[model samples]
Target: MYRPPHFAVDDLPTQQALIRAHPLGLLVVAGPGGLTADPIPFLLDAGEGPFGRLRCHVARANPVWRTIGAGAEVLVVFQAAEGYVTPGWYETKRETGKVVPTWNYALVQVHGRARAIEDTDWIATQIADLTALQEAARPEPWAVDDAPAPFIAAQMRGIVGIEIPIARIEGKWKVSQNRPEADRSGVAEGFAAQGAAGAAMAGLVRDFGRERG
Candidate 1:
């Protein structure tokens, strides 16, 4: 992630929150053939290492498990995105004419070492815990044990669990932090005016301004 100083976001708490809130991530790993990426829904198990660990599962037939071996480094990319930033929002666009169109969003890059959950008991626990966490967020939460024993066992057997001990995290928040206050305010108001995702991004721009104050 190449980030300029004005666009850099080094806040750890913010990064973790971004990753957690955006449960779906792109897990990328290298293998003999080439690089592979999987869009997976993961659980952030927050009690393992200092930065905790990431938990996810892949279909047993998916070759990704074999490539992501013990101690193999992996990159998990989470996108906490909003909307596009229009050039007309910037005051400089009409004044000095020094601004161009850019995107406004947040993202996190977590680097970790992976270990395959091979133990049957541990794998079962992982499946249960993951299902519980995901269901907890729904309107009518579904329990993992709701399924029949034979069906659940069969389903579990078809998947492989993964545990990623996070080694490092890098965050980038590009919500017009590089702009001056006047331009920032102009952008915020512009976003709020559009009544799209831009409206939420405006709040992020405003928050960053408040923090710098």
Candidate 2:
């Protein structure tokens, strides 16, 4: 991640929050054939290691697990929020007509050595935890135990578990922090007028933009 100082997200708590909110990660690794990327939802176990650990699963038939061995280095990319930033939103565009279009988004990249887990007990526990995390907000939350044990066990057989003890994390939050205060405000206002998609970007600007000096 090539992040400029103004757009970097170095706070540990902030990065962790982003991961929890956006649990799906693009898991990428080098394989015998080439690079393989799998979109997988992860569970962040903050207490597992110094940095943390990521737990996810892939289908047993997915060739990625076959070529990428246990303990191989991998990257999991978590994308938080993203939206297009129109040049027209910048005050500079009106003042000097110098601004061009750019994108505003938040993302985190976690680097670690991944290990495949074959233990049925561990995989079951992970699936249950992951299910709880995602279903917690529902009025009637569903659980892995909702189904029959034999059925759950049979379903689990079709997948393989993977874990990564995080080595490093890089986060980038490009939410118009580099722009001047007036320009930043302009962008937020512009987004507010554009509806829900743009309003999401506006919310990020309001939250993180205040932190900028």
Candidate 3:
């Protein structure tokens, strides 16, 4: 998280928004066994604390849970709307030929003390809420209760829940904000032409670029 002044995003709401939009986070931990990382989908409860609380789960068979001691410090990284920006997209490339390629991205890094929970009720509620969040837009949404009770119980038995109360959060939005107005506009136009894959980034570039200008 090397955040330059231009790329730093300190707003709490903005950081939480990215987490909600990109719920899958890279969970990192350093324990007695050493450092380990895993990709896990998370739920953010923004009102829970000064920063917020994060909830997620992993398979019981996964060794990650075992490594996390009570209140162990951990980091979860959430990334949204990112892409490669070619130097060709910068107007400066034509003017002075000084621009180089770079990656444009928006991300949040949350540092927290993690606790592993084995309570069945907590895990059940966590999975249900997570499922609803992801399935709300689907025409035919599925629920944890949709399956047989025994089957659901059996499946739940194989997983463990994780909860983290956020201690610190940092957001970085490198969306052409460091570029000049003309160069930023060039980036917006180039990314806009890329359709859905670039839509989010294009909007970010335009909005942040305008703010800077």
Q: Candidates' TM-scores?
A: 0.91, 0.95, 0.96
Identify the runs in model 3 with alpha carbons over 4 angstroms from their true place. 210-213
Better of 2 and 3 by TM-score: 3
lDDT of 3: 0.92
Candidate 1 on 1-213: residue-level lDDT in tens?
987777777777777788778989999998898899999988887767878689988999998988886777899999985677778888888899988888788888889888777667877888888778778879988887888989988888888888898898888888888788788898789888877656667778898753332
Ranking by lDDT: 3, 2, 1
Candidate 2: clashing pairs of residues: none
Native-vs-model 1 lDDT? Answer: 0.83
lDDT, residue 2, candidate 2: 97
Model 2 over residues 136-194: C-alpha lDDT tens digits? 99999999999999999999999889989999998999999888888889889988888
> lDDT tens digits, residues 1-213, model 3?
798888899999999999999999999999777888899999999999999999999999988887885688899999999999999988899999998999999999999989999999999999999999999999999998999999999999999999999999999999988888899999999999999989999999998874442
**Model 3: worst 10 consecutive residues (lDDT sum):** 204-213
Candidate 1, number of clashes: 0
